[model samples]
Target: MAVKSKSVASKIVLTALVLVAIFPIFWVFLNSFKQLVDIVSTTPKFIFTPTLDNYIYVLGRDNVQHGLFNSIIIAGLSVLIGAVLGIPAAYAVARYPNRFSDDIQFFVLSLRFLPPVAVAIPLIAIWLDLGLYDTRTALVITYTLLTMSTIIWLAIPAFSRVPREIEEAAIVDGYGPYAVFFKVALPVAAKSLIGAVIFSFILVWNEFLIALMLTTSDAKTLPIIASEFTLLGRNVPWGILNASVIVLSLPPLIFVGVMSGFINSALKKKD
Candidate 1:
């Protein structure tokens, strides 16, 4: 009886936690379909006529479609560059343990721990001086600081778990160092590497501060564009704001759904 009671209480607690997490998203989704007047009402209306006007305005006005495109370009390129640089560095750190290797690994991990605001001032100044501000390339390169750190840290453990014997055997079988790394070690660590890349892409996709500071118009990302909806002084456009939130949230939601299979496969392989 006690075990059953405990189990029931645990389930109640879990359900409560889930509702707390989901209520905000549910509220936003509901508001996204409401009219401006309906949204701003003192007493919230449970039942109302839904309209597509908010979404229409969000899509049609302010070149939001362009901002979405810029977000994709910046995030994709940043993760790609970060993965390329971080993978080899991680492999080296994992495979070869020396004073220099340990130091390099520590430095990389330390950068991730540092707050972005600490460096944002000087970083923006340098970007302005170098004429790289407000460019996609600049965002991609700047974002690598965090993305590279993520990949290096995550990929290190993945590479470390790969059997050294497998690498040596591949080397003995007439495979060069590069070939062994690309074929043997990489395949074994591919799942973890993919996870690192996917997570970094998601992180960069939702990034606001650096994107806001470094970009103004030409390269403004979706998050920045979402914040722009409130620039119209006194009255906050709740409908449009909700609509933008819904739109901004869709890509990440879709990505997580799509990547569910990949993550599951990685887990299955480990088991």
Candidate 2:
């Protein structure tokens, strides 16, 4: 009876926590469909006529479209570049424990720990010096630092969890180092690696500080454009802003939803 009681209580707690976490997102989603007056109403009308005007207004802007495109390009390229560089480095750190490996891992982690402003200040100067400021190329390269560190940190454990015996067996079958990594270790760690890449993608996608500091027009991201909605002074377009927020959130959510199948299959394999 006590165990059953405990289970019920735990489930109740988890349900409450889930509701708490999702309530803000649900609220925003609801408001996105509302008229501006409905959204700003103090009474918080639960029943109102829904309109597509908010989405229409938000999406019709050229800047919003360009910012969306820039976000996709920058995040995708940064994650791709980071995965190519960091995966190999992670494999090395996991498989070969040299004297410097720990130091290298620590250094990578320390980069993540530093405040964004600290890193952005120096990068701003460097990009300006190279005449690369306010360019998508600059954002991609700058975001690579964030993505690479994330990939290396997360992928180290994934690679470490891969069985060494499988790698050794591949070696016995006359596989070269590169071949073993590509065929054996990589396949085994594909699930976790995908997660690392997705996380890196999301990090770069939602990143506002560095993007704000570095970009003016050509390289502005979705988050930057979202913030621009607030510059309308006192009568902030709450419905339109919420609509933009929903749009900003769609890509990562879709990416995760798509990749969920792969993650499930990986789990089934491990089981």
Root-mean-square deviation per candidate:
2.9, 3.2
Worst 10 residues of 2 by lDDT: 262-271
Model 2 has an lDDT value of 0.91
Error (Å) of candidate 1 at residue 119 is: 2.0
lDDT of 1 by residue, 1-271 (tens): 9999999999999999999999889999999999988988999887999999999989997569989999999999889999999999999889878879878888988997787776667778988999988898888888999899988987888898787899999988999988988999999988778878888888999999888888879999999999888886688889989999999998778767547865674466563
User: TM-score for every candidate vs. truth?
Assistant: 0.87, 0.89
Q: Quantify all predictions' global Cα lDDT against the true fold.
A: 0.87, 0.91
Task: Give the per-residue Cα lDDT of candidate 1 at 91.
Answer: 94
lDDT of 1 at 207: 90
The sequence of per-residue lDDT tens digits that candidate 2 reaches over residues 1-271 is: 9999999999999999999998889999999999988988889788999999999988999999999999989999999999999999999999989999989999999998899999889989999999999999999998999999999998998898898999999999999999999999999999889888997888899899999999988899999999999886788889999999999998888787646764564456553
